[model samples]
Target: MAPKHDLQYPKGAQNTLNRYSDRGSYDLEKVHKIVNSTPVLHVSFQPDPSDPFPAILPMIGQMGSFERPSSSISDPLDCYLHGYISSRVMNVSRAAIASGKPGLPVCIAASKVDGLVLSLTPNSHSYNYRSAVLFGYATPVTDTEEKEWAMEMITNSVVPQRYDNTRIPPIPAEMQSTQILRVTIDSASSKVRDWIPSDSAEDMANKEVVDKVWVGVVPVYETYGEPIPSPLNKVEKVPEYIEEFLKESNEEGLAYATAAGKRPLPVKAKTNHDE
Candidate 1:
């Protein structure tokens, strides 16, 4: 769980961090990998009255990179090849190295997946979601070999086999021009709410009379359609590999389609509005 002090930060930052904290810990490695892989990260920070903050900061700047386990191997290239671009800002390059802060760079994120589950009684309303927030600081990657490893880790984090398919990253000059920040998390917290609708006896009795409209729920979901080949390409048939990519279940397909400009199919699931 994230410390109470950390949660006091900007709501927008918390939201962003929560969106990417897939496995609990405000995972710096995952966050950095996702930020670099995805394009157009949404970032917002209001200046604190007590301390002046940068007015026009980049989304990618808000979160910094972090170290990963020596043995762990996750490919980010797969995500890129599938069309998921990293959501980040390039301005992280300008942040000062010595802020004089004692702790490492830390960030918090939170998210609510569904609408508030309104109960028949006003007091019973609740929400269904999974949220996680983290706190940590970033360390710049300086070693040439380490930087190369970091880039590879970032790539593998998204796509398992991407490094094998793509050319190796540039060396020396190109690598030197790029900056990599490593984040070290201090603490984190996770919360969730998944429940079915429940109504009070009085509300149930008055349901039809109070509202003549339909009372049952209408399902909502995420879905995907067959991939459309690029117009410029002249392939006789959809490659089996590409077709396999299309067969992924809805959420995976939606994540992939988000960058491809393909419309995601709607999945059928009950909604609060329907009720």
Candidate 2:
């Protein structure tokens, strides 16, 4: 049988995984899943000498292949991040290109904690998590078509079918104020921890620690709150699409967390590519 085409990037060399190397993966599918599943991505970059320290911001983004629109998570793709047009990071990216540099170097980090592990010993306490770190160069997206597509893609990701349910295309002024950063990842690595606690032989031998203490995994998940309708809204009822979305999405989160990365998370409703 042919082997799966795992994500091929600089492994331990570029972003080394010191501990738990067994749980680390360079596979594109695994890494992309963690990145997309995470609603907020923390991006870090070096600041100019005028700044006091490194800059890190929680931003929203997704992985996509614009050229190959049908590309799957297992395929090579670029990370498109949404930001304000006048933001300092965006300005730095724009300046880098003018200086003959491809883009600004950045580090992208994301994670999802599935459960809290309670073990016999304090040292054994840990979180069941899926995490990833990507090393990349970011540039401000300039193409009109790609930028529009990315904006719509991001909107749909938040709440399925949300883009169409609202005003169609945004106005020119709205588009002008928004900016999208295209991050071309050079290499990335993902780490996952979802196993039951394994107590040391010394600790296991002690009946008080093993039997008396509550040692187990407490599942954690994200769920949507009740949808609030506008006071001036004209709709008679909550649309089935939204109700269905809430049901499916909320259940999917619980299911995925319980499964502990063993199953794929449910897909979000899509949007019109032309929108």
Highest lDDT: which candidate? 2
What's the number of clashes in each of the models? 46, 1
State TM-scores per candidate: 0.50, 0.90
Poorest 10 consecutive residues of model 2 by lDDT? 266-275
lDDT of 2 by residue, 145-254 (tens): 99988988788778778888889788999989999999999999998876566556677689876778987777788898788999998998999989998899889888
Q: lDDT scores for all predictions?
A: 0.40, 0.82
- What would the per-residue lDDT of candidate 1 be over residues 150-172, giving only the tens digit for each residue? 66655554344555546666656
State the local distance difference test value for candidate 1. Answer: 0.40
Where does candidate 2 stray beyond 4 Å?
A: 1-3, 50-52, 261-275
Candidate 1 residue 188 Cα shift, in angstroms, is 0.9
TM-score of 1: 0.50
